[model samples]
Target: MNRNALIAAMIMALLGGFLLFAYLKKFEEEASGGAPVKLLVARKHIEPGTVVTDDMLATRVVPAAYVETRAVREAEKARVVGLRLATPVQAQQTLLWTDLAITADDKRDLSSLVQPGMRAVGVRAANDDKSFALMRPGDRVDVIATFPIEGSTQRQSIVLLQNVMVLAVGLDTTAIDTSKQGGSPSSQDLLLNLSLTLPEAQLLSLAAEKGRISVALRNPDDVRITDSLADLNSNLLTDSKTRKTVQDFRKTPTGPVKLPSAAGAQ
Candidate 1:
């Protein structure tokens, strides 16, 4: 045949072969029923412990081969509708069953925030005691317990918990909202939530019930655990010279007044 005719035939043969391959592939996919599956994905950045709502979720159709093993199926929408996210999910990311905290109540509960073997215990404090409302979530603090000394009538203070994380300060856990200056939380409703082991939770509860509890904010990097239980008496003064000088001044009266003798006689 002619050179032009031969090239035209080859092009026509290639086009026919491409069409046949496409038709066969379509038939195979239909026979196997391998269509794209819909996966539930986060429409926005969902933070951990957030309740899953309709507005925050969307669906994406992924090929059967590309579908993730643990991706939440669109058919299971009801199961995850009210559940909480155990970890943060980025926008347009496929939601996984493992990422959610499934509970019968289908609510975002505070217990979910507690560690596996730990408990979340809340302790009430006077507003003036806990940084005057400056404390917020994730702040580390040392829980101080003040109660009457066993034998003496004076009150002594001791650190009950050191380098403990403050889960929630007051009812709000995210931040201290001061938008409405006149609607600040009352001192009576102030609370400090803590994550502690079972034994530690019990000890903290007992201390709160029996004595006064206060929190001393600490530097985040200060993880030093000291066994030193210093008493809150005058003797606790670091400088002995200053303590002695104050003692000598208190003993002598500035004005001329009749002083009682150290002996029984007045």
Candidate 2:
């Protein structure tokens, strides 16, 4: 055979062999389940600003065709910044979705009143008492007030309120460090400005006029609802039943029951 023809035949043979090998490889891949099965990126709990790492991918026990490349790619770009994650991901509780807005004023306000999920009560602080230094905004306390009648020695120290929120201390709306005092802007000496309801405020004012007020710390678990003196007093004085009883008592004859004189009886 001619040299050129032999060379051409050899090239053609090599080409044919290459094509056969490619075909066989393709057939083997088809018969043996194609490429390796991979994980699907779950859509739930995908937080904003969260970096998608290999660990974030969700794998399945059985190889399935439902896993899409697009889903995986999308998950790779997911991030979390502020919002809460609905579900916890593997080894990760989804990142925040948005920025949390927490400011000094917010913290101060929250420290005072009933918080988002908390219940609050009101109590009175004494103007002349020195024990206010012992109380704070978050401190739990039982309020006691004593009222003395005019021109009389009788005095009653009753529990005016309980489980009340200490909103502020000595006009400091925010939290204060009571431990240290006497510095620049000299801190007020533990004068607490408590948050009280309208009725509690009235009671505080009334008690301040007649007697002294004091506070007692309570157990963390001891939350009691005390009677509102204003409401009780108003009801006792104005209620129809109470009014009728008072009226009947007043209408009863004041005439003294006559006992037989000793001489008459003999």
lDDT scores in order: 0.71, 0.49
Per lDDT, the best of the predicted structures is 1
* Separate clash counts for every candidate: 0, 17
lDDT of 2 by residue, 163-256 (tens): 6666555544433353475443224544555556667777777877667777887654455554443212333454798667645643444212
Model 2, position 169, has a per-residue lDDT of 58
Lowest lDDT 10-residue stretch of candidate 1: 249-258
Off by over 4 Å in 1: 1-108, 127-132, 176-183, 187-189, 234-266
Q: Considering summed lDDT, which 10 consecutive residues are worst modelled in model 2?
A: 93-102
TM-score of 2: 0.37
lDDT of 1 by residue, 1-266 (tens): 69999999999999999999999998887666557798999999999999999888899997664553346789878878887887799999999765776543442345544545667788887646535367755677888887876777667677798877666666544333333566666763477788788999988888877778888887755666666544465343766876676456445453124546887765
What would the TM-score be for candidate 1 when compared with the true structure?
Answer: 0.46
